[model samples]
Target chain A: MSQAVPSAQRTSLAVPTQVALAGVFAALIAVCSMLPPIPVGGFGVPITLQTFAVMLTGLILGARLGFLSVLLYLVVGLAGLPVFSGFNAGIGVLAGPSAGYLLAFPLAAGLAGALSTVVLRRGQAAAARGAGRMGFGWWALVWLCAMVASFVFIHPMGIAGMMLALDLDLATALGADMVFWPGDVVKNVLATAVAATVIRAFPALALRRF
Target chain B: MNLLDHRPGTSPVHRAPLGVKYAVLLVLTVVLVAWRQPVVVGAVLAGVFGLYLLARLPGEFLAPWRRGWPLLAFAGVARFASGVFGPVPLSPLDALGPALVVMAAVFGALAAARLLVITTPGTELLDGLAHFFGAFRRFGVNPEAAALAVNVMLRTIPWVGAAVRAHAEALASRGLRRGPVRLMGPVLVATVGHARATGEALAARGLPAAPEPKHPGPDYTRGA
Candidate 1:
């Protein structure tokens, strides 16, 4: 009882706040998919809002709970709810070309969230004067961490899905992976840029409501 | 099988037991996986589309596709590009048939799923899942937390989606929408803080603790 509320001034939030934020992040993933994507090239993979959703879920929800959120989305999709990109769902999707990416959502979210937390802690401590004043280089490092995780974990799973479903060899699959890269990179850059801006304007956006 | 809380009006599919429905969906998915031939896959697609009609699912039910179709197209293109650019040497024409068929099948199945979910309430699905996995207690799993996990996931997906958009719109108002890096940076920060707080809350509530195991033998407790 002597905990004295642990000084809410720090990073963590109360229980109700966490639930509220989790709900908010999940909803953000869904809405991000709804906005029309601007296609980058002939490969047809336009940079959509999915990365922002997955990364934010991980960065905010952490490894376990963040995984839970993406898993829930997948379950909802499997159960026939249209929570996926384009609002499509069902078991058939699990076997299709995109199955790998679909399956990777939770894993990707978990990886990104875990990696980002490390950066967040370090960044917070380093930026001792005024919570909002983050060194630009540190912000760049956080971006690199997120991008690397997505590229390493999510993309490979996605390629495997393509290979298995499409009966393509690794080379062929890599080709497909390349197509998604440019567009995804663009999305990541955009997501990160917007994320930084939000922090600048509403530092509260940087704080967890959960 | 409905995951979202929205159960539609009375229908045979909606009324079916969640376990049975999930089993059927799983079996069908396995069958789809087992059969790779385009003819078989096409047949499955046709059958799924037929089911959509049978369920009386509305055209607007495919509403999410308005935004999603492009992503599917991109993926399809990526598949073909990989085939052509890489050592595989698959003709674009060859890739198109399977890609479109796969996309159609996926969309159809999702459409069917959407109809069912929008109709069924979430609580029913949770209770059904809890009862179905009731035996997992032996593994030190709390059926309640497991069930709650499912519920929270279902509840939050749409929530996170809305938050991302609101953040983006707010950003856009200030004339800031060029790359995901810029957009997601703050969102990530906000998200991490939220996750930590959430974990703390669950801990405070005495969660992460396993529930009592179910009785193992035939000569069980009082209920037996």
Candidate 2:
């Protein structure tokens, strides 16, 4: 039942709708970020669902809008919205120990979205090649990409921010940041699984020209 | 859904222009960071309280901090614990100074930001943002798009929140106690489905399309 609509036939949304989608995702991110963090005893770096929402933004919205969605969230929070983790806000939140992770959000979403487009495109090509089994591989690739983005973008920046804001050396900073890895892995895996399930149920979603 | 704690008032702080309030908040936050002294942080915290009072916010406005104080206390204790196990053990008094400073600065910053949010309505905040970013229009930035996004997000927060709660309850009723994780799949499906429907609605309305580039550049960068 899948019709291959030409990219030309698919219309770009109205500016208002695009903005609305971005805003919706931004609010999603904020809600996720501000949810009462799972209290991990020391260092106060609570396990947060912000990363999960970030990955979902990329996987669902594509790159440009994904990036803008996150950028908008950050701008609003910095503009004195009580939307940051622990109900915090202001430019000072960016100056705090968690700044690295916070600042890396847009880049993380952009990377995840770009990687998702590539992976889904390849999956579609493979499916056309009569290799339906490759669908599982593509799903795995989506998860891998999310994990890699977190490691490459979120963790490193977070460690650096911790180092500067908390005044700890590299080793200590790394130690502090390591606490969130397990939770992050779980969150990203869930994000990947959810995205894969949604795309499978709505094949047209995978066919969109990002 | 009640994302902003803003209480309508005719107080001077509430009457001041959004830009001026933002400017004042920025200056105060800068000084707090730069000074990093207990006295400075304490003074700023006091100033924020004064502004809160000036805005005539109800006493309950600070109620959220009741749940927050324990965490702040834990933070101070964690610092002292870290100091004791450090390469060079710090005396309790020495550890206490830095801990208090960190706590005070954080508390002060949070108070100041809350005050801003508490006084400014969400719509006015979005308008201020649109105005603030208007200057960037010359650089190809779109302030209307940005404002629209923020506005949409403000509206969606409650919708998504309710969806999550509803999904969680559905899962729980089905004998799945571990609801949140299991709820993710359904929530994602529903949200993506809603987004697609929204797109279709926009298309059906015949919204104007963005102009195509004359050069017809390579499609390699389509997703980027």
**Candidate 1 structure quality by residue, lDDT tens digits, B1-224:** 23344636566666777776677566656656566566876776676556556655545456536645755565566556655665656687776776666555445444445544554566665566567445777775455665555555555555555556777887889997645555556555565455556656667777545455466556556683
Tell me how candidate 1 scores on lDDT. Answer: 0.61
**Candidate 1: tens digits of C-alpha lDDT, residues A28-81:** 676566567766666665676777667656654566556766665665556555
Question: TM-score per candidate, in order?
Answer: 0.68, 0.83
Residues B1-224 of candidate 2 have per-residue lDDT tens digits of 36666778899988999888888877886676567677887888788778878888757446445635664564455445555555667888887787777667656665666677777787788778878777787787776556655666776777777877888889888888753457777877776666556555645755324434568867996697
Which candidate number has the best lDDT?
A: 2
Return the lDDT, model 2, position A191.
Answer: 82
Model 1 CAPRI quality = acceptable
Worst lDDT run of 10 residues, candidate 2 chain A, spans A1-10
Model 2, runs deviating above 4 Å: A1-17, A34-46, A90-92, A207-210, B56-64, B70-89, B177-181, B202-224
Cα error, residue B41 of model 2, in Å, equals 2.6
